[model samples]
Target: MKTELRVAAYAVCVRDGEILLARWVDREGRKRWTLPGGGMDHGEEPVATVVREVEEETGYVTEPTVLLGIDSIRRNWLRRLAGPGDWQGLRILYEARIVGGTLRNETGGSTDLAAWHPLDSVTSLDRVELVDIGVQLWRDRPPLGRSRLTDPANG
Candidate 1:
């Protein structure tokens, strides 16, 4: 079987010891905080995709300063939000600096609100494992390139 691959870009925005995050409400009305970004569009550059996603999701104009690292995650189809289907995604993480724009909620977007949380208190919030990875990349940037085996399925 041919494995399907998806390419996504995400941004880690930090300022004043706080990290910017988007709160997404699931179908059950439970909220989860995640980085500001989304899947890359055809012919879109990774950096460009991150910039656009951040602005669209959080209303902040950001510039990706550096490519933090790439995460290759594999998960069962049923365990994913997309329902049962095997998935392997290559996520490009970026360290970004907010340059302009005011913060606003993205109406009709996947996220319900955007806010900054204390870096140390991020663990207290309900977040995905990818959030932890982004924080680590921001706190202690690894040697770059690709970082694999991130998802539990591959472990």
Candidate 2:
């Protein structure tokens, strides 16, 4: 068994009545919409990573105004190299706004297309969990710190 931890930063950009989203196509050719950000490089700040990733994936320069929250997911998978393993994903979600640049599809990147979808129509699209989480964060800016939930079974 092996353990893998990945830390990523995501941007939630909303303008007018639409939200910016990037389309991600999986290895099996399935497409799902996600935020315009990805994993942070070693020694890179979360803010900088979101800025670079947004520009790369959506062709727009953005400024992160607030850190909405952190979303973490842990799962088990079978990898060819590591065999059965556990992986945890910690996503730093931020509320950002476009500062400049024109809208264009990403090239040779994780996302092939970038588009703005009406907030009302988002529920109909095939999107990842991040989309919902991002929207919630955008709607309600939580406290500026970590949140802990108690488990009843522990009591």
Candidate 3:
């Protein structure tokens, strides 16, 4: 199988016990709440990527404070255009604070809505694994190196 790697950045902004999240709507019309971020542009710094992506998805101007950790995931899938392949995603997570802007839904973007969810309520929301990994890294603040995520299904 062919292999492809995607490098992305995500922001975790928490204020007043609430976490900012964006609603990711897939091609199949499935929706999941996720951190406000996405893949980086060529040559863009991860920090800059997260800042831009968060603003694009959540309508919030944020300043990243700390590099939380990295989360990686590998999965096998059959794509219509790429055919059968192994896809690996490397996500850089960062802790950020809102500097300006108001909460609003994205227009004609990957995410349709953005909102602040209670940290305690996030556990019950439909979300991607990256969301959990990002939050864990933020809360745990692992030192030394990036935190790696293992594929539970494969393990």
Candidate 4:
């Protein structure tokens, strides 16, 4: 009966015709593609968290050119057979430009590889939905504020 809220950041690292991404083998040993960022630490700014996370995950220094948008996911744990609203996460997406460093993976990190994937091929890859959102945000810079949507039932 406890709600767990997690605040995280995601970096859309783009260059040339490719996008930098972090790939990992999950606990089940399945490979997945994810953005180069993670949860924000205490007292850390979202921008700083994104920058640090990108470096840690991809070994590349980056500058946040623009904060694309925020993505929030809320799940009712009770309905999920766990607890009441016990799982939720908020992710802040930022458009990043790689300024330095080489492509490498962070040892002992969640991701085991870092590589650039073609933008056009991204959709074909098995990636999280947030990855598509980040690409859309990069292509279309939405309003400079919280962009939220409510389901019809919620409305």
lDDT order of candidates, top first: 3, 2, 1, 4
lDDT of 2 by residue, 1-155 (tens): 89999999999999898999999988888999999999999999999999999999999999999888898888999978779999999999888999999899999988999999999999999998788878877786668423232113334
Candidate 2: where is the Cα deviation over 4 Å?
A: 144-155
| Clash count, candidate 4 | 1
lDDT of 4 by residue, 87-142 (tens): 78898999889899888888998888899999999989887667777887788776
* Residue 123 accuracy (lDDT) in model 2: 93
2 versus 3: better lDDT goes to: 3
Candidate 3 per-residue C-alpha lDDT over 1-155 given as tens digits, one digit per residue, 9 for 90 to 100? 79989999999999999999999999999999999999999999999999899989988999999988877878899989878999998888899999999889999999999999999999999998878887877787879335545435534
Query: Comparing 2 and 4 by lDDT, which wins?
Result: 2
- Name every residue pair that clashes in candidate 3: none
Q: Candidate 4 overall Cα lDDT vs. reference?
A: 0.84
Of the two candidates 1 and 4, the one with more favorable lDDT, higher being better, is 1
- TM-score attained by model 1: 0.86
RMSD of 2: 3.0
User: Candidate 4: where are CA atoms >4 Å away?
Assistant: 77-85, 144-155
How far in Å is the alpha carbon of 133 misplaced in model 4? 1.1
Best by lDDT: 3
Off by over 4 Å in 3: 145-155
TM-score of 4: 0.85
